[model samples]
Target chain A: MIIEGRTWLFGDKIDTDVLAPGYAMKLSPEGLAQHCLEAVDPDFAKLVKPGDIVVAGANFGLGSSREQAAISLATLGVGAVLAKSFARIFYRNAINIGLPVVAIDLTQEVAPGDILKLDLAAGTLTRLKDGYHRELQPMPPHIIDILEAGGLMAQLKQKRGL
Target chain B: MPQTLTQKIIARACGRTTVKPGEIVTVNVDLLMGQDASGPRRWRPRLEELNAKLWDPSKVVVVSDHYVPAVDAQSAEILNISRRFARDYGVKNFFDMQGISHAIMPERGLLRPGMFVAGGDSHTPTAGAFGCYAAGFGATDTTAIAITGETWTTVPETIKVQIDGALGPEITAKDVMLWLCREMGMENSFKSVEFMGSTVSAMSMSERLVMSNMAAELGAEAGIIGVDEITIEALKATGGDYEGAEAWVADPDAHYYKTVTLDVTKLGPQVAAPHAPENTDDVGAFAAVKVDQCYIGACVGAKLEDLQMAASVLRGHRVSPDTRLLVAPATVRVTEQAAADGTLATLTAAGAILLPSGCGACAGMGAGIIAEGEVCLSTTNRNFQGRMGHKDASVYLASPYTVAASAVTGHITDPRELRTSTRNAA
Candidate 1:
């Protein structure tokens, strides 16, 4: 699948609290989704449309491992997460929940609002139209299996005949 | 060709007899996990669309940690929904109001060496203290574990933290971790960190737990203090039911991506400022900052030793009239024993407000939130802006002693400075 979206660039260590702040957590996922990235960029949620990608620096998803962080992004229709690195929990949670999370090392060249296309199978993140194209280390085949099946539960259901 | 504990655990889980450094392997997991704030409820419809059933029951764990004691009716209802899901799914490893899942997992024997673990909680990596290939996942990923007992991991390159020197009295593992979080930014190593030092060898099981528990705060995929006598004793005390107790340490020549050193002598009381946990500096840096709330509880603060340290500082001295002090025990056992030992009495008599034995008020799940612009000095992990209930509220993360001393004086003050008032009252 080639995911086409606008890029929302964030620096390293963008924590869960900032992604989906705790105060907003009391609200529903949709409600919280509106405030996603409000702590960093107040206009983030209001300006973005569906199929957007969040490109971040190293250690993305750095605190609490709260699924709300991933859910907030997904509900906002963020098609995928591209980071230099991901916090272990956030990375797994994102993939399990079917949010495509990819890692590329050239975070220095990616800019916010740059339209990009991510070919999950090709391990290529190409800047659509004006963005730069960079290759990423693709997730393993089994992980692609899990992601394609729409996370762990679906993968298990297919495997165990559930 | 020595293998690191991480390599060994990953290799074993994947059925590979040996794992050389930097070789990637797919592994099966022993357990999958999630908690309330970031559970699979929103993703449930997606799972249904995908036509999935719960995976292996024995390998799944769901906890109601972030909103325990269900502060508001909404939170209570949310927890009820989670509980109903746990019951309907026949998932037996559910923990509600028991304590932080990271703290309770080891107590319940779910974390063991040579096992791979993933949780929806970032601190899920806390289980790596058991020498397991443990990491945290997001809700979507946890939904996979809830339905499947495996996760894919690129074998992480290991980083070694070798600590030495002696820990002074009042210096706890929390300080060591905070020191690491500071030295290594909250994402310092990216993945795989193992702690080995003379000081680590000298630390108790409780101390090591604290050290590994906060490893995620540094953005590590997993953190471990090499298994030794203390680990064996700790596992035994927690019910010795684990099968691979001896397989918890690394071989001597294991490869590491980077190696760091902490002398322990250079460490002191650490405090993380609001909006970020890694904004940690020496506690003394905030000596004049006023506090509106003082909280001591959560996975880190609930230890008996932590309470005793706070009690020792608060003994005979009253908390400041403007300050509110919230004391929560990490576990029921610690809560019960503290009451029996009069430690609870000493804290309460000194004007500390007692809360239940869960992760109360730490994650802003219930109570203890400060007013807008108010500042709170807390003993829990995470000081991210807007973390403590109100987006405008500010929090300073500190050690238990610093929290108590600051509470008594209504401002940040070193514990040593409070000795005069405590002695005068006596």
Candidate 2:
């Protein structure tokens, strides 16, 4: 699978609270998406375009097991998330919800608005601006299968003939 | 092959004799728990869309705690949906407006040894105190578990934490967890944390639950403790079956990815400052920070024992005029127990306002939330930015004893110092 998008840089420990703030939890998924990253950068939801990629330092999506954190990003059409590391639940939540997330260190090399391309199957990332490339650890086959099916629910639906 | 308790539990659930770390396996879930915010309120629509029903209603437990007592129209609607989901699904173990799901699960004898559990909330590892492999999952994963009675997990390596020596007066499990959060950074993802040693063995099930609950703050997949006589006794007290509980112990030569050892003899009451649970230090380090509110609530705090800790410090003293004290028991049973034992009386006599039993204020929902620029010393687990209220508000984490002591002084104060000073004055 290939994904291309402009990059949005974030720092370490970008927790679920900022990604989907508690105050906006009661809103619809789209309304909640409007408040995504509102605490850190108030303009994130308004400024973010479809197919934009989010790159962050270690422990992205660190707190809360709310799937809305991942849904908010997906709702805003985030192409993929690349971080140095991720909290276990958030990583699973993102994948289960059909949001592609990768654990790779591109925070230091990638800057905001840098267009990048990701070949998930090949486990490689490329900065379109300068042709800078980095190898990424490939996801497991089962996880890839789920993502290809557009999430666990979709995969389950397909398997059950529902 | 020798296996850690976590591996043993997973092996049993997956019907495997052995499993290795980093291997993905789909394990049958023994029990599934969900709260108002993450469980039914979110799962209802997804389940409808999938045209699916619960795999087994008896194995599921639902609780309405997050938006209980109808704070507003939206919250009231959320609670209503949770109720409808429980009834529509034929879930017999539904707990309505009962308290936090973590504390309520054990109180009702739902958790048992060697069980593989999944909970909707992040603090689900609190069940790990019962010698189970209970880990938190997001709504989508939980929904999948609800439909199939199984979910996949990447087997996690175990990180053993051994604590020795007895806890001194006023230094409770909350302090130890705050200390652990700093000592072991909150970046330990994809790992299970197991607590062992003389100290853990001597602790009550309540204290052990606190240790496992905060494993989320440590960023661990699950926090577990080996089952012992204390665990058996607690299980019995709660009317839970404990047959074959002794078999859940880890092998003597089980391998651990890492081992951390701590001696509680010299450890002081610890505190984590604003913004992060990992930003911790000795209680004295935060002495100069005056607090506008001292809150005791959440699954990690406000248990019966936690309430007793606060009552012990507030028995004869009063909350400072400058600071307001709020105590929201974790569950209704905790409230009843505290009231029956005079713990609630002691707290209220000291000017502590009691809120309804729920995850109030701790999750930045419900009552007692602080305003911008105000400071609160809380007994809850996480204190991340804007978790308890305004983004500019500062929330500090500490034990119930320290929170109660600070409530009395209007500043961050050590519980031991207040105890000594009270004796000195007497």
Candidate 3:
């Protein structure tokens, strides 16, 4: 339930349309990440390294229920998405797809390219540089159970042997 | 506890008498919906992984809508995947040539009152107009539901939106929703939204769908409308033998987290400016902004009456030389009806280009895509920074009437202004 990675900062109200632009929808699953955030950060697909973290302001993923928003990020191998807040469906999609999303006030704590650590189990986040940190509010137990099993699908498979 | 509609519906789906906000419960979905753009992407292979046939094929509805006429080999592949899933799983309600499921489901009697419907596409909330607790979920969730006919949700509190008085003759549900978002903001983001009052009861299913579909813009869990005689009669009129309709009204003492009321008589046509749906203003204040394209597409905006409104505005008039008008009907049945009623001919004579019966410009998938740096007054939902292909191609969301009126003037003109102007701008 703990992850550490480089930071990729974005602003508030990042919608799903730009998260995975509709024009790039025909691309294969992994190819979707290639266009992730290309509207705002044209070089995101070319520049993002695996296991990176994305931090943003309030109402992150504030648009459609296109799972592409979360899938594109998952395909990019993001460690977690730390935001001031999240739109409800996007929050559910992230957890259902095994992406740890925490709502916390961390916009002033870390900078882009800074290494930060997140602990979903203990509800905490720590900046690897200055060791500055804060605790996050834990998700509900049912959601935590899904995240702990690596996502809803894996959790369902494990529990029901589907 | 006094139950809101969300509590009542969720309780019924979960086999409980009552439920509360943030209570996670397993639900028995009455129907599962998947669109061509999203369904074929995952569910088929996932069902194979689970070694399962569909829990009950009769309850599944798959509509090939997003990329109709097959934009490419890839689009055809997705369409074929939907067909294969339907055929292989024995899903009885598969409609490939129907244009859009949001309109087709209700028109075909698949959507009804007192049902728990879940779909893969975001605009699936449109189905909630029939008094269903319907909302959009992802493909993975669709896979799980296909396997077990069940899903889970954390029940949300209700934000009851009441529409009082009569709507102005020029006003449409699109304006009503934009006004609500502008006034309340997305403050009701995580709550269930119910549209009620005299204005709503008088509005047709199309009008109600327009209001419910915008609920997603509020980030609502489900945009709900209570079932009344209008709902039942709309179904009966469909000629599809829709007899299962039931009345599901909120109790008189229903508990709502918040109540917001609007007198439509006092409200006029409204429009949302570029980049956000909540940043809205009256159409009368919009005059000098020239437009490159005027589009009417998506399930929310492209119904029969919407086309009729646009056609009436453009009856003998031609579209301005500088502006291009694109009409994409939400369903094939709507297109046929318009054709039968001469609405299509009127629009075509006015120089409107008709796209397939699906989401054409809404996602910038095929036709109606605009150039960079151009401004478009569109009827589709979402005016995100890069929504319609190019990030700089601005889309101003409004009702079909506002879009049509703007088309005549080649600028953002008010629909009410067209009441006097007899001729189109040259």
- What is every candidate's C-alpha DockQ against the true complex, given to 2 decimals? 0.54, 0.80, 0.65
Error of 2 at B23 (Å): 1.4
Residue-wise C-alpha lDDT for candidate 1, range B1-426, written one tens digit per residue: 687888888887878877755465656878777777766454466567667667777777887777777767888887887788788777798888777787778877776666788776667767776776777766666665565555556777788999999987677788777778879877654468898889988887667777777887877778876667777777778774555667678888887888997798867777888777778888778877989889998887677778988999888789999888999888777787789999999999999988876666667666676778889888887888667766788888878888888988898877766776667777
User: Which candidate, 1 or 3, would have the higher lDDT against the true structure?
Assistant: 3
User: How would you order the candidates by DockQ, starting with the best?
Assistant: 2, 3, 1
Q: Which ten-residue region of model 2 chain B has the weakest summed lDDT?
A: B383-392
Instruction: Quantify all predictions' global Cα lDDT against the true fold.
Output: 0.78, 0.93, 0.85
Q: TM-score of candidate 3 restricted to chain B?
A: 0.96
Q: Pick the TM-score winner.
A: 2
For model 2, how does the per-residue alpha-carbon lDDT over A1-162 read when each residue is reduced to its tens digit? 888999999999999988887877889999989989887888889988888999999999998999999999999999999999999989999999899999998889989999999999899999987899999997899999999999998998897888
Task: Tell how far residue B348 is off in model 1, in angstroms.
Answer: 0.1
RMSD of 3: 1.9
Which candidate wins on DockQ?
A: 2
Q: In terms of TM-score, how similar is model 3 to the real structure?
A: 0.96
RMSD versus native structure for model 1: 3.0
